[model samples]
Target: MFRNIKTYREGALIEDEQIKSYVESFESELLRGISTLSALSIIQRHPDEGIYGYQLLKELEQETGRTLIIEEGTLYPILRKLERDELVVSERKDSGGRPRKYYKLTTKGTELYQHMVGFFSKLLEAITPLMDIEIKLPEKKFIYCPNCTNKIPQEAEVRFCNICGLNIEGLSK
Candidate 1:
């Protein structure tokens, strides 16, 4: 495809293979899936509840129905980065025996989260009508267990995922 384009430009004759490889790499970076939004969503739903690190992992896993791809190596560094940005703050909690660090979003973080939600909602609204599709809200449903992946039928402020054992805001499915 790029072979003909190379000759069309008089001065610069870029090779087809070289151009193809460069374009592919650049596109991959642009399409890489990142979930900073998921983190924001978690904070927004539970503004007052301080979230534990392990709980975040479980929540993400259950919500997406995919492995978070965040292993022992990368989790702490990302947490530190978020904390450094002041979007989230960490504190220690000693409940029964051991101490656990819980993360809570600051006021600025809350506002940012709400803004992101609205922006994405508006974007979806614009795209859907153009595609000739009708968007309908789903009825309320039970929260699925993050570990067991079982659905819990009752409505609660926060529901625990059985599959991964993470607490999540109960939203209408």
Candidate 2:
């Protein structure tokens, strides 16, 4: 009975299981590419104080409105890889009784995160026109970096140009 209403293949009716499988596969493949960036961004936000593994997962869920759910077991391997690459540094801290490892971004990681942000911005701008719905930028005028002319939104809380590494706090005003 359920299967009768659940299938679609091209224009014709098909099994719902096939559609579910296809969606799961597609989503997994896409998330695999962006997971590193997502993790990096979370770590970057808490630069001064490092965050532990479980807390990082919780933050990711909270920040993304729970849409980007990653399993607890999968998060460690990603953190280990980031540490091995020297993008992030980790140290063990004794909390209560158990030792929890906290991770923070290194200088290299911060620079890489900035680069990734710029890349993602440009990518979204390029693809906005192709999307079905119209997209709009904020009405406030954008500020360009005096050093490198990189355009930044007026509301951005950046102190330096991600592209040129120039201190822009004074210049933005």
Candidate 3:
């Protein structure tokens, strides 16, 4: 007495089990492209002490309020990519019991994270009007450089903008 939910895949109508696999594949593709930020932010959270994969995943879930649950298949690849990019470094350590590979942001990663977080915040604020949402970023705490407009925190001792090399020392004062 129930009707199947039909979805068009490529050209043909797909339903039931086929639709599930088709949709899942499509979902994974979409996720794979833009999921690094969450993982990066998690690793970025811990500076001196690095985080293991499982702990990072759990923190990611908590940070996003349990909305995003990333699988190990996706997380590991992203970590490897970040390591290859020199954005993060991993070390195997035996903290208390079993040895675990912990990941932490490199100096470059820290700078990149600042810029990315700033950009993301600005992007959210910029798109809020279109999305019919409101976001109030702390303007006083950040330095939106006049030259590049790359967002950065005022607390950081930055003389020139990391992205555009704009002189911001005077502006920081």
The models' CA-based lDDT, in order, is: 0.58, 0.74, 0.78
User: Tens digits of per-residue lDDT for model 2 on 1-173?
Assistant: 12223445665433456975776678777776477888988898888879898989999988887778776788899999999999899989988699999899999888666566556545566588788655443324555555554556667888878778888785635
Q: In candidate 3, what are the lDDT values of residues 1-173, reduced to their tens digit?
A: 01123345665545456876877778767666447777888887898899999899888777777656687566898899999999999999997799999999999988877777777777788899998999998878888776556777788897889988988886744
Name the best candidate (by lDDT): 3
**What value of lDDT does candidate 3 attain over all alpha carbons?**
0.78
Model 3 compared with the native: what TM-score?
0.77
lDDT of 1 by residue, 1-173 (tens): 12223354444434466776887566444323245556656645556768777777778667766433345445667677778988788899985597888888887666455444444444555579799886542224444343343444545454554334566554444
Report RMSD (Å) for each prediction in the order shown.
13.0, 6.1, 5.9
Q: TM-score of each candidate?
A: 0.50, 0.70, 0.77
Which parts of model 2 have CA positions greater than 4 angstroms off?
Answer: 1-15, 134-173
Evaluated against the true structure, the overall lDDT of model 2 is: 0.74
Candidate closer to the true structure by TM-score (higher is better), 1 or 3: 3
